[model samples]
Target chain A: MWDGRLLRVDAREQAMINEEHRPEIGESFPVHAYYSDNQKVRIHSRIHYHSYYELVLVCHGNCDLMVHYELNAMVAGDMAVLPDKSIHSSFCPPGEDTQVLVVQFMPDFVYNGTLDTVDSRYMAAFFNSLRMKRHALFQTGEDLAMLQDLIWKLLREYQEKRMGYTVYLRAYIGMIIAYLIRRLFRNEEELINYLRDYHRIEEAVSFIEKNHREAITLAMAANQANLTYNYFSTIFHKITGHTFTEYLNLIRVREFERIMLGGGNSVSEAATAAGFDNISNFNRVYRNLRKSSPTQVIQGLRVAKS
Target chain B: MWDGRLLRVDAREQAMINEEHRPEIGESFPVHAYYSDNQKVRIHSRIHYHSYYELVLVCHGNCDLMVHYELNAMVAGDMAVLPDKSIHSSFCPPGEDTQVLVVQFMPDFVYNGTLDTVDSRYMAAFFNSLRMKRHALFQTGEDLAMLQDLIWKLLREYQEKRMGYTVYLRAYIGMIIAYLIRRLFRNEEELINYLRDYHRIEEAVSFIEKNHREAITLAMAANQANLTYNYFSTIFHKITGHTFTEYLNLIRVREFERIMLGGGNSVSEAATAAGFDNISNFNRVYRNLRKSSPTQVIQGLRVAKS
Candidate 1:
């Protein structure tokens, strides 16, 4: 949480809250919160990319944020929205005492497994950042204050993990995204065009979700979206941070997990029912995607049930 | 829309746009849009109440909005959120040339037949207004600007009626409500308390929805909410603007309509299935709530289908 208590923390504790918790594969809710004051300790300056969207708010002092190799100076009340797989890094001056709050959430956190156009619009700013080659930044006065307040509430809810915290987290995230989109896209025509294109991609995703049980291909999904295979593949990877095949496999793995947890099915049966052809191939894909074996997941589910 | 074109319209054309379109009892989408300029014509000053929420945004000049007998002087860029059945009227000085935009929508537009606490929180401001005895008025600078932009887009979308217009309308309405809640309840504890109270009412509503087919009473709902019967009755009426019996009857009428439209059910059968035991009482309540006969609705549905 971005509260006043953080101002008194010692130098040794500066990085304590900055330890990132990367979302695990198939995690139900994949939102992580972090706070850092770089004047007390060295900030992470390495250029890297992740498979989730990151929203950073500069609470105090100044810093430089690099998105897609473009450096932009940011002062207090500035916000940076970095899209998935967009290479980004940050730098803080030695004596500026720069403080920031960072929130990382997977695309699923916004989409929630649905292809609603409004949900796609929530992600418009992030994806638009890629095309514009400039990250979505909000520097307005009152709107920035409201956004900061929402982020603080989000961080507090995340840290406390109270009953129904995830519900509040999602609500706050939706509000933040809505605010960012309205502030970032001042041109109505640009917003409409972006939403139309996103709707097309969502159509393709909806196709995959419905047909994951069958032998589906990128060409089929592209046809559903009325886009060429290559074009669809490029934008799909850019927007989703996954190749078509990888995404399909991930969906199948998720379905397999769902079926296994639903009970009354053996591991192989669930795997085959999820469109995997053979046992060995399913095992390989499952391990590569989930970072865990099928047996281990089943054991974890059983333990949780007990 | 709140564009400049409205400024050029003649006095006779003023009420042309302000003509209210109240939502029919079973209307699929229950949202209406209106634009008014008192300079062009006489404003609707007669005190009135309706069965929907009304949101008013002042675009130019100033006006006085009276809610529940409390008069508030609103300037340009001010907004008023009036809860359902709240007696309200407006007064514009003779030469002030007050221009405003109004949006009216039923609770179903926001709740959409769900018991989600987040959805209830969106209506927190409106419900809280009754207790606070003053309507929700947003006076901040940038936030109000963003809200005006959204209302303009909403009015445009409503007038154009393009493809997926309802989707955009709902999205914009959600954003507006979110902004109002955040701005109105700056105190975090107040927000939490309001949400808790709203959630309790929503739980009672959810119970009614699930058991509407059974003979349920106010005491039953109060028990479900863990509130005293008298307290539950008072708060439920105040928050929902309907007595417990009236709300239950409305729910049943809605269900009966749903069943009749689903095809292959007689009006009597639907009414009985919706928890009305006698045909005469069913007809009376249906007529009182929906303002139309059951056979007329079935005929309309049939004609539309054909």
Candidate 2:
């Protein structure tokens, strides 16, 4: 996968910020860990988005990385957070071995449990690309030192499968995320600056999530956004890439499937549980997106539970 | 964790069978994988039972294992299956580094997915201690060779983690399990002979599982076992180590909690959904087992989603 295009980066290209790039780590837990020296040739040159988050720590030699579309120098001991679904890539710097360690995991790794409860208002850093643009590299002396300690701790936890290592792994990763939030961003306001409508969108999205089980209309969402119906409809699509009704239906379908897997029986019951008063419409939307029937989905769940 | 008690095993111990010993992997999935050399000492010598399943493959050196309850020799290329909730232990035999690979995961890792759809009777090797006795180790020439190939493939998939490694890992493990069930068992009758009361006990258990939502009595259970009420009660307790009513309540509480987490709202609703006709009794049992109210669980799930 390597294109063998390592190059030097001056001041200008290093400052450019890439947008709409998201990367994925594939696995959700026990972060994907890799170490390489000469094998660094496989750090592909393709600039792409991953569906999960990634953490790259320089263990030996030096390198340059284009994270979120910005160039940054990574000497030995440098580290950076490639936020979930963010665009990033790595390259070997001229005349360097660039031995490094990579640890990546899916958003479900931290986005599922206690860390998610504090709300996005508190988790502004993880959702912000601006912060990722400015402080992409852990270059500050204390930040680098602290990060190295955490990285070694993670490597130790991964290397040694002691009792409750999963718990430790998550806790250590939580520490890393918490550290990034507290240390990387100057304050909460700056962290949320990437998206001017971030809070409004978050609140509107939260409202839709809370009421997806109820009879919701476009006007209701527009009012929740404190915008005129037309503007709200337009901006919601612009921000989320989905129409208001479409997004609501998506939420409902996801919840419907969750209910089915969680042991709710029957298509009608799951539909109602997922906030659908009309069975035919729910089935239509479900089939449209899933390309499968509700019965088939429930049967799959039954098979899973068998 | 090493007890410094390595020795040669006589032919007598090499032929013994261990019973009722369950080994736990703690984390369910995508599974806990570990590589060890001298680090094998960390596996401990407790000779204890675990709540989850485990797989141990000897990569280097020779050793003897206490699987279930019996001592057996494990050399290079030998692999042992530590069935869930079965008693087992390991010790490094004299000479060599005793390098090995360990893959451990919780019951839910396999029990919840498509693997369960085949019916536990056909997948009986996983649940049956009787079969555990007949074929704990893949020592036969063909079985050992096939297992080594699977183990190496697993190790490679785990180590390199090329694209879609998680999908590949699950598939490899499934293949391994399928191979065990197919290759290890001599024949259908041979497989059935390993378990004397497998069918009867399975039928009685299935009945309780199906009827745990109703007001099930000891007499009902005895009738399912085709034994007199008193005799059935005695054997049920003897086989399962729990009285019929106690086991029934356990099932009810577990199902009740499952329903609550599955999106059933309100304590009363979850209780009813779990098959509890009487509120006070269900509440008492739930509190004793969970040490928290159903409301707390719902709130926790909410936090998990947030």
Candidate 3:
């Protein structure tokens, strides 16, 4: 099991095995907490990614978390920070009975769209995990135990949904993030680098989001960060694991679906409104990003609504 | 000692007795944490106020905190939430050896200028304290003890000035605020009312901050809140404990001082830049609000710098 053979999966095959998981989160709160065990692990054994940060703390038994070419073995009191959209999977041997607490939250849940330096600094650990291509893992220790206790309280608060639960949840998550930053990044230089990269990509991401409907291009995004087209493209891919065009199309497809699901728009109308000039191109990009035809997803949405 | 006579101080006398205390806080990280005991309390015994929220947790002995016409007798494990600029004083009888943990922070330190609903909701207890003319006091209990642990940790973090102390300090404070909201306001309606009032006043305050250099009026502020001039004035005074004109002039005086301290500007130049049209009128308002003439304060500033 210690052999490094499992780390040699081909890029194309890894992409084929990866799945996107969108955890259910309240729009206003944007945080979800739950527990995962071996049985749950088997059910979701495929490499998976989501568009929000996930923090996992092991409670019992042992498991291995794979992020790209690296594997981290985790045990009781061990914790892992999985940045958003990082392809990874978890595994536990038979009879291990591994249990882990999981917390998933959007960046907005913590910072709430404020561009303040300190606010973005809380996200340093998450961004570092993505940039390094290795999940941030904390082994069994006193600090990890303290954080585990907080995570348990967070899960309880989420389960109970008591009065002012959202406020409490946000506070708990903020504390956890702070703990991660204080532990993971030892010096000021590491944090500063992470913060700088976050802002650069964040600027490009924000620009794309604001003007995705206006036929924006990669060069325009690069200009937003004052970087050359080639360097910006390379950094964007390294950080996000997606080419700039791929990320842009993913956003456009998501917006298209949102417009359609809001009930009054036709497929072609949404396609155009979401920045696609041609239906064929829109359908192809939607399928590539979502692994489903646009029509099928729309039908599923309608069926679920009905 | 519990007699109601102490609660009958006249408003004019209270104003004369109340002093403005500006706690030193770093601009980037606007939080200051310290411990206060009877000796320190006596030094600051006169009723005083500051333009920042302060949380006080009693660690030992007994003290009485007088806010406006009300008094709260606080003992060990008691905590008090004092809103910004709320005239209040603490008294500990001789030999009590009272000690308390004090955490003062600007509202921006937590919410960071986000107008998000939940961000404002974290401030409910503070606003409620100001509106009700009574400080929010949490008595000894299990929950308070838990919060006390966080506060102690916060004070340690503040003292240590570690690598990411600001992030940790902010997290601890956020948790404390969440605990306050969860414990103090048992229901949603109270929180909703407090949140509404915060937003209303916050809107007018933001307007004054942004347009103070121009000619603005109480009527315009009322229009911002969509309330009549008389009603807005009443609510503003009830919430802030200062008449509309008093608060406006106080803001102007603060702006004027800020300009002068930045250097190179004559007193008249700074006063005009801060929206004061006449030097005499500026001096009168400055002396009334700050209890010091403009020239005197400016000279004091220069002397201190030298």
* Total clashes in model 3, counting residue pairs 3 or more apart in sequence or in different chains: 0
lDDT of 2 by residue, A52-110 (tens): 56778787677777653246777887777776545456678454566777776655554
* Candidate 2 local lDDT, residue B170: 49
Q: Name the runs in model 2 displaced over 4 angstroms.
A: A1-30, A38-44, A93-97, A112-116, A129-135, A143-146, A156-166, A186-306, B1-219, B222-306
lDDT winner among the candidates? 3
Q: TM-scores across all candidates?
A: 0.44, 0.33, 0.60
lDDT per residue for candidate 1 within B113-155, as digits (tens), equals 3343433444544455533333567675666677677788788
| Candidate 1 local lDDT, A1-306, one digit each (tens) | 111111111122223223333554124557888788887775556445566778889888888876642567889888888766555567776767888988887665544333334334435544554433335777857666767777898899789764445545665666666566566555557667556666678888778988999999999999999999898998787555578998889778767866776674698999989999899999999777545677776666455344
CAPRI rating of model 1? incorrect
Can you give the DockQ of every candidate in the order shown? 0.05, 0.01, 0.26
Q: Considering only N, C-alpha and C atoms within 3 Å, which residue pairs clash in candidate 1?
A: none
Q: What DockQ class does candidate 2 belong to? A: incorrect
What is each predicted model's overall lDDT from 0 to 1?
A: 0.67, 0.59, 0.70
Which tens-of-lDDT digit does each residue in A104-130 have in candidate 3? 887666754335555455565455544
| TM value for model 3 | 0.60
Better of 1 and 3 by lDDT: 3
Candidate 3 stretches greater than 4 Å from native: A1-23, A39-43, A112-114, A117-134, A193-306, B1-23, B39-43, B112-114, B117-134, B193-306
The 10-residue segment of model 1 chain B with minimum total lDDT is B1-10
